[model samples]
Target: MIRHLVLFKLNDGVGRDEPRVIAGAQAFRELDGLVPELEFWECGWNITDRPIAYDFAINSAVADGDALTRYIEHPAHQAAAGQWREFATWVIADYEF
Candidate 1:
């Protein structure tokens, strides 16, 4: 399986409670059942108050590179990512485990 991890940092002026941020987060939370290539899904806000920590994170797993690609290209995923693009920037990592 491949583990896909994402870490998000909100834009300089954005807040977690802002409607747009809330909605974007909700969109991702809803993707677990919407994308067929997502075999596992977990996401949430960061609990730490450190500068190095990202504001949000997504911890997921898929069958392989192909599955990971499908998950990334899925419409629901694309839409959710688009929402985040307006208020945050993120980094991702994928590895076999």
Candidate 2:
């Protein structure tokens, strides 16, 4: 399986409490049911107050690279990512297990 992990940082001047941020987070939270390629899904806001900590994170899994690609290209995933682009920047890493 492929483990896809992402760490997201909100843009400068953007707060996690903002409506758009909240909505963006919600969009991610809803992806599990929307993307059939996902074999596992876990995501949420970060609670740590450390400066190095990202504001949000996604920990997910898929069958393989092809399944991961399908998950990335899924309409729902695209939509959520588009929404997040307005307020955050993210880094991702994918590895096989």
Candidate 3:
């Protein structure tokens, strides 16, 4: 199993923080149906850290490296990611377990 956790930091003046984060969460939620190897998917804001930490985060579970690859390479995911890159800092990490 692998827990592919990622955090996204947004650039300044991109948009209102909550709305941008909500849009990202909605976008990530779409991957569940589109990516076969995506066993589980969730997204949320970093409330405790407030304005300090990354704006939002994603939690994904995959079966293995191959599964992770599928999720990363899926066309739907690619499209979603392309849009995210316009506003985000960078992908945090792919945690394999």
Local accuracy of candidate 2 as per-residue lDDT tens digits, 1-97: 9999999999999998899998999999999778999999999888779979998999999999999989999999999999999999999999999
Candidate 3 lDDT for residue 58: 83
Higher TM-score: candidate 1 or 3? 1
lDDT by residue for model 3 (3-93), tens? 9988877788775355754566677778876788988888776676666678778888999999888888999888778778777775657
Q: Taking the candidates one at a time, how many backbone clashes does each contain?
A: 0, 0, 0
lDDT for each candidate structure: 0.95, 0.94, 0.77
Rank order (by lDDT, best first): 1, 2, 3
Comparison by lDDT, 2 against 3, better one? 2
Q: Which window of 10 residues has the lowest lDDT sum in candidate 3?
A: 15-24
Q: In model 1, what lDDT does residue 74 have?
A: 90
Please report how far candidate 2 places residue 48 from its true position, in Å: 0.8
